[model samples]
Target chain A: MAKYLLLKHYRGAPAAVNDVPMDQWTPEEISAHVQYMNDFAARLEGTGEFVDAQALAPEGRWVRYDGEGRPPVTDGPFAETKDLIAGWMVIDVDSYERAVELAGELSAAPGAGGKPIHEWLEVRPFLTAPPTITE
Target chain B: MDEALLRSLTPSVLGILVRRGADFAAAEDAVQDALVEAVRVWPADPPRDPKGWLVTVAWRRFLDATRADAARRRREDLVDEEPAPGPAPAVDDTLQLYFLCAHPSLTPSSAVALTLRAVGGLTTRQIAQAYLVPEATMAQRISRAKRTVSGVRFDQPGDVATVLRVLYLVFNEGYSGDVDLAAEAIRLTRQLAAAIDHPEVAGLLALMLLHHARRATRTAPDGSLVPLAEQDRGRWDTASIAEGVEILQAALARDRLGEFQAQAAIAALHADAPTAEETDWVQIVEWYDELVRLTDSPVVRLNRAVAVGEADGPRAGLAALAALDDSLPRHAAVAAYLHERDGDLATAARLYAEAARKAPNLAERDHLTRQAARLNARRCR
Candidate 1:
């Protein structure tokens, strides 16, 4: 089975169709959205396609080595410019079509007024190890 | 407790239970229970005959579970005739188990998990840890695989190639968590080689050994990748290399060459060399040609280009690479190496950076990044 990553962006992605931020949404609508996302993951797990899903903190920094003994340089969280990933879900499915279908369903998660957000979720395929028969 | 001994006996014990009329899933569960018991009990009290002990215990567990289930009344007739518990017949059904675990119906990942659990005798948790998946996910994968293969009769002859492919996948997983999957793969392949007399099986075993011999030197103390040419040959396992070479020679003498045998021949040639500079790239290229003929896979052709580069010159290698699809995995990396060899430092540096971004894994990415950084630094100097 091939593994695919469905990435949710905190900042970098294009605006969703609904466009309303979570804080602006009604509490009931937020709960519904959360429930839908959870149900989606649970459904995938039941079908044995789910690998892992995780949420990332918005804050991040870029660090680089200054020298052998130096403490290293740290850049900002880059709140507005840099691509800040909100979270991701990893799924192992039988085909690219299945991956795409699931990603489409996930993108349909409800937003304000219990309507589909139609968010632009980035779908990336993981590069796998070369098969032994290759050698 | 002797974990290896227990694992070695696991398939045979499970096979006995299944042959004695227990269904595959139940038999496997019972065998796992027996193994768990062995781990818990055998530490204080060792069994006189481990396999016999396992068979008896696993069979009893299977019967108990069957009787406990109301829906399993259909299996009562099969369980009624329990043979006397004693030394298991020398009829090794492990090969059948291998085939079953690698059944065509299951996905490659499912097959791998099933083979590790049922054939490799690894616990679900262990397999989970090795695969970096949740134990529940791995458990479900294994159960699903077992369910998929449950309907297949045990007597049906299986494709050896499929079994080999599963083992090869396991081997290529390398090491993670507490399990060294490569060593386990070698052990399984060795077991398969003992069970069957196929030259390809021997070829696979030899190939694993040859690769494993150089494993220690493949990485540096800082956990960075070491290219083959830069590895310390003095530290390579000569014993393993010797054994691998011997096995490859015997397989080659048979003249019935398969893809594994051809690949092993290539590995053997690399092992035979005194140094990377002295490596018989011409012979390696010939083996790659044979591999291209056998598999016709673009990956093989990509690898062949690397060998061509070594055997002839950088220009020749680049010429060979020009014929293949550039989208192939490691294509950029190979192109970078050849360009670097051809003294096109600027092109090599750019390619190295591009390859680093496209690398499949962290280690390879880091290695390619370093290569790019090295070239960039050299150009600046």
Candidate 2:
């Protein structure tokens, strides 16, 4: 099976309000989006297909190793990565085409406007290892 | 065949498929398919030679699919005859598989998942449970990893360190999934050490044994983490300890010291101690110093600080901690411990809570939270 990384984050995963910003969405629409996502995650969890899901904090900093004399310093994660990852899921499936299919489903997870966020999801495949008896 | 038998024969069957010119990724997929079919067919008519049967069926399935696929037509043409009929591939194939799985390009988590599925014959769900992730996520990771490595020619040799790390993680997991991950890791590592002359391979085995010997006592009677100091020394496996120590001593005598060997030495010291008070904190610190020289990992330095604390005093440890990066995980927790030791309960409690909030895994978070709660209770009392 081909694997795909389903990137998750406020901007990465489906956020219900792709057309309108989350702040612009009505309160009822926001609640509906939240309910939709919760139900979607639960449904995926019920299936064996759900590999992993996480939500990371928005606060992040860039770092570099410093020279012997100079101390290391922290820089903000401010390099215009609008779709920064808060979390991700790695799923193993039958084919790359199938991975795309699943990603589409995940992308459809609700956003703030009570419609499919269809947010930008980064799909990455895992590198394979040695053979198994089953393969 | 039973699950135990399935696991035992998995590597051999995988080796056979690889020998028959199935690339590593394709062979793994075919073998998994055969195992599933076996689970379905075996209960009714169990094969006398399970390995032979699995290799035969999986190979056929591989051929059928390869022939059907437009992209793999060139590789499929290399298979002179579709149905593979042969004795198992040499032990060398098995060793090669280990190297392939541990390729440096793959992440440690992906490597572990691939090895467990291919070498250990574990199900995707089983692997997911052990790591506390959903099966789909793990399955995707494994598949993506396979596709990435599919381009790497099987004939080319790869870095052994990657393989060692994967095997090390497997051993360290201590049997969370359907398969006994620790045992599978040992079996695979033993296979690796036999094929390669690397001293660290021996060191890894020794490390596994040293830590594994006390695995029986790692958990408390209530199933929580029992710190090494609180462990019942009597429950330790003396035989495993002896074997580990012997291997470690042999490796050390060679004077080709490596990180694994240094870590094993530290574990060996812990095993040698009859009581927490009698622990050779000074020697352990010395080993940690060697480790820092070999690998400048911030985590190693963090640990060394603890050893420094034990060898000298909590104040010394705190000073060392202050020199470290503030972003390292468990930094706050270690600070809390050192602070508590220095009679700074308020600071310790606050740091402990902060550490608990930052904890990655649930068990660790719970344990840290408990530590904070216990301190709060004591303060009130």
Top-lDDT candidate index: 1
Best by TM-score: 1
In model 2, which regions exceed 4 Å deviation? A1-135, B1-6, B37-53, B67-84, B89-91, B132-136, B173-175
Query: What TM-score does each model's chain B reach against the true chain B?
Result: 0.97, 0.86
RMSD of each: 3.3, 12.7
Q: Report the C-alpha displacement of residue A135, candidate 2, in angstroms.
A: 38
lDDT of 1 by residue, B39-78 (tens): 9999999999899889988989988888777355554555
Instruction: Give per-residue CA lDDT, model 2, range B1-381, as digits (tens).
Output: 477788767777887787767887888989999999999999999998788789889998887777767355555455556643776655546666776777777766667788888877788888877665666667776786787677776657777778887887777643355566676777777777777888898999998888778878876666566677888999999999999999889889999999999999999999999998899999999999999999988999999888888889999999999999979978998899888988899899999999988875555677788889999999999
Tens-digit lDDT string for candidate 2 (A49-118): 5655667887788888888888788898786767667677766554678678877877776665467776
The CAPRI category of model 1 is acceptable
Q: How accurate locally is residue B264 in candidate 2, as Cα lDDT from 0 to 100?
A: 92
lDDT of 2: 0.77
